[model samples]
Target: MASSESSLFSMAGDSYSKYEIRRRNPNPTAAALLVIDMQRHFASIAAPILPALRSTVALCRAAGIPVLFTRHRHRSPADYAMLGEWWSGDLILDGTPAAELLPDIGRDPGDRVVEKSTYSAFAGTGLEEALRGMGVEEVIVTGVMTNLCCETSAREAFVRGFRVFFSTDATATSNKDLHEATLKNMAYGFAYLVDCKRLEAALAPKI
Candidate 1:
């Protein structure tokens, strides 16, 4: 694609995400923020969205909302599962710095980090149980690969009976088409689509 066309695609997604239409407003009393796969590799491509994500994290923290992050790591070929053949190269190797969350997100030591080897944070993970244990009813999903990890996790959350709030500006992807597709898919059926400023503002008044 030409540089101009790519830029146009980027602008189009930004325009579409400007509106914060949602199926439901997150109940601050029963909400959690799932920051999925915000590691070095994807985070570098999606760096522009981190400011919005960082601000959202701050608001959630102030509100005493549970903020959990998922680190995508494969310890061995056995653990790779479908992700092994789906992607062309090794990703988020265990014990490597690349597998760790980016340093700029202001993650505290007390914060929880769930390690996963798949796209959905809930897959083969204790995320569901942990949320249930916390008495969380709503999950505000944010992080990298909007069409992949974010979308899958949102749908999984919905099926598990958690009200899903998908973050438009706070989630990022390398391609605009895939990102927009996820947003539309979530808005059409699975989750309430939200943006950074609006979500932050809503949480602010209560925090």
Candidate 2:
């Protein structure tokens, strides 16, 4: 293939690229913020992005947008067969510190907390129902493991007919390349990509 043809095919495969999805402000009533797998294990490696994550959460709260947090939990060894042998030891056991959300972040008593064992929050959890119950049509996603849990949840949300806004800075992976790759992929086709700062400004109360 000619160089231009190759370039065209490459760009065609990417849906999250800026040239593909022009960034737009989310419609107010349709949007809610979804914080996925922001527990201790992931949060520890994401310490650098803590400030940005916190700010995003606060902005959503102030805007009266529903904020949902997902906690990954799995069964113990005795009951783990149902969850799969591959997850036996790697699971985030219920009530364990590793499964707990970071306390320093904003989490109100009334905020919805959904426990999920799988990568996609909507797979086994009531996250979709909860969002629907609240009349939410758009999801602003942020959290850990940009290429894993976060990306999975965002894609699921999109397939379920919700507009997904994925925060670039509020998510982190074990390596920068994986993180960037996930963002690029999601932003190109799966979700709307926004940095924490832009999202915060968008959610800020009009003066």
Candidate 3:
């Protein structure tokens, strides 16, 4: 599992290196970490990245950047949308254990948690408004299903005028191929790809 996780980071660095630009590091004062869908439903997928994700949360906290989480779930058919049709009853229902965020995640009582019914956290969730109210101009995205929620949120964030930094090691999916593909796509246009190590250096307090 560790090797697989390591390869994801390597591939992300290699694949996105060309697109990296100068001064893209997220400014702590203007940034927030968006931990997406780290719920029990995707526990296996989230397992490998848990340590890195936790580190990411801590790093952001230490840097004085706010950390928020998104939890995806459906209350009924009224909110299911196409996810229900596509997943064929595999949807995460509200109030179920699968819909709950993993307890081990580094979330604090004061941290804001957004609930969404779609892959895009912005969809009907008022996340953008919340971030705006917080004076956040940049977002660091991390969490489960790199090809789905993370990718969708990153693209939406880009179009919504937020500079996005996507975490490679702190996010995961069912397989490495899908994960790396999202990284390539994000690097090509939507966001700057960052791993935990990059985040550490970028967010570390200056001497």
Best by TM-score: 3
Query: Cα lDDT for residue 68, model 1?
Result: 96
Window of ten residues with lowest summed lDDT in model 1 = 1-10
Model 2 worst lDDT run, 10 consecutive residues? 1-10
Q: Which runs of model 3 end up more than 4 angstroms from their true locations? A: 1-23
Q: Residue 50 of model 1: what lDDT? A: 70
* Cα error, candidate 3, residue 64 (Å): 0.4
How does model 1 fare in lDDT? Answer: 0.78
Backbone clash numbers for all candidates listed: 0, 6, 0
Residue 95 Cα positional deviation in candidate 1, in Å, after optimal superposition: 1.7
RMSD of 1: 4.1
lDDT of 2 by residue, 28-97 (tens): 6789988877777665455766777788888787787878888877655554454556544466778877
Comparing 2 with 3 on TM-score, the higher-scoring candidate is: 3
